[model samples]
Target: MAEVAAITEREIELISRFVVLLKDEQDALKRADPSVLQEIGAEKIGLAEQLNTLEADRRLALGITDDQNTREAMAGWLAQHPEESTAAVNWEKLLELSREAKQLHELNAGLVAMHLQLASDALTILTRQSEQHHALYGSDGQAAPVSGSRIVDSA
Candidate 1:
C-alpha cells in the first residue's frame, strides 16, 4: 500500500511537470520563437518518455496489463482505501491536465500548418511572377513561358 501511494505521488508530480511543459510549448508557439520551440520540443519529448516509463511501472504495480484494465484496477484500489481521497483527486487532476495538453498540442499544430501554407503561397506567388510572361526567344524565334519552380504541387 505504501508503494502504491508512492506511485500515485510520483504520477501526480510527473503530470504536474507535463502540464508546465505544455504551457511553455504554448507560449513558444504563440510567440513564434523557433529556438524556444525547439528547446521546448526536446524537453517535451523527454518528459513524455519519463511519463511513459512511470505509466508502465504504475500499470505493473497495479497488476494491469492493458489500458482497459486501468480504471478497474484503480477502482479496486480506491474501494480498498476509501480514506485515500487525495489519490482520487490527484488522478482526476492529472486527467484534466492531460486533456488540456492535448488540446494545446492540436492548437499548436494548426498554427504551424497555417504558417507553412502562408510560406508556400508566398513562394508560389514569387515563382509565378518570375516565370509568367517572361518569354525567351527559342531557336525558331518563338516566345515561351519559363518553367516556374513551385513550392506547392499543382496536382
Candidate 2:
C-alpha cells in the first residue's frame, strides 16, 4: 500500500510536469520555434517513458496484472483500504491530469499538421510559379513566342 502511494505520487508529479511541458509545446508551436519545439518534444518523450514505468510499478504494488482493468482494480483496492483515502484522491487527480495531457497533445498534433499543410501549399505555389517563369523565357534569356502567335515580317 505504501509502495503504491509512493508510485502514485511520483506519477502525479511526472504528469504535472508533462502538462507544463505540453503547454510549452503549444507556445513553441504558436511561435514556430523549431529548436524549442524539438527540445520540448524530447523532454515530453522522456516524461512519458517515466510515467509508463511508474504506472507499471503502481500496478504491481496494487497486485493488479496487465490484463486487469486498472480503474476497477484501483476502486477495489481503495474500497478494501478506506484508510488510504489520500491515494484514492491522488489517483483521481492523476486521471484528470492524464486527460488534460492527452487533450493538449492532440491540439499540438493539429497545430503541427496545419503548419505542415501550409508549408506544402507554399511549396506547391512556388514550384508552379517557377515552371511558368521558365516557360515564358528560353534558354538564351529571350521571350519564347506563344504557340498561337507568329512573328510578323514587315515590309
Candidate 3:
C-alpha cells in the first residue's frame, strides 16, 4: 500500500537523521564541549522520541500489531510489491547506520570516561601537594607555615 511505502521512506529519513545526530554528538565529545554536548543530548532525545513514534506508525502501516509478526508481514509485502522492493535495501541501510551509531556512542562514552579519569588524577595530585604544603612564601621570601589548616583549597 501507499501508506506502507510512505512509512518506509519516513523510516529511512529518520535513520539518516539519527546517524547525523550521532556524528554530531561524536564531534562534540571529541571537542570536549560540555555545553555543545548537552545541546546535542537534548537533540538526540527529541530524535529518539520521533523515531519511536515513526516506528509505531511503520508497524501499523505494515499491519504489524505485534513485533513478532513484523518480519513475516514485511516479507509478504515485499513479495507482493516488487517495485517497492527497495524498501528492503533502505531497511538494511538503516540497520547499518544504527550499528554505526551505537559504536560511535560507545566510543564517545569511553573517551568521556578517560577524560574524567584524567581530571580526577590531576585533582588528586594537586590536592595531595596542597595538603603537604602548609602555606606559600610570605613577602619576606620565607616559607610561611600555617598552624593547623591546609591552605590551598580544592573542590
* Every candidate's lDDT: 0.74, 0.86, 0.75
**What's the lDDT for residue 128 in model 3?**
81
lDDT of 3 by residue, 1-155 (tens): 66776776777787778778778877777787777877778888888898788778878777677645665777787787878756777666666777887897888889889889989999999898776665566669876655454444320
Q: How would you encode candidate 1's per-residue C-alpha lDDT over 14-99 as one tens digit per residue? A: 77777787777777667777688778778888888888887788788777787557767887877888787877776676677778
Higher-TM-score candidate of 2 and 3: 2
Q: What does the lDDT come to for candidate 1? A: 0.74
- Which candidate number would show the highest lDDT if scored against the true structure? 2
TM-score leader: 2
What's the number of clashes in each of the models?
0, 0, 0
- Which residue pairs in candidate 1 collide? none
Tell me the tens digit of each residue's lDDT in model 2 across 52-153.
899899888899899999989998998999889779889999999999999999999999999999999999998986565435555689866434333431
Better of 1 and 2 by lDDT: 2
Ranking of predictions according to lDDT: 2, 3, 1
Those runs of model 1 whose alpha carbons end farther than 4 Å from true positions after fitting are: 67-69, 133-155
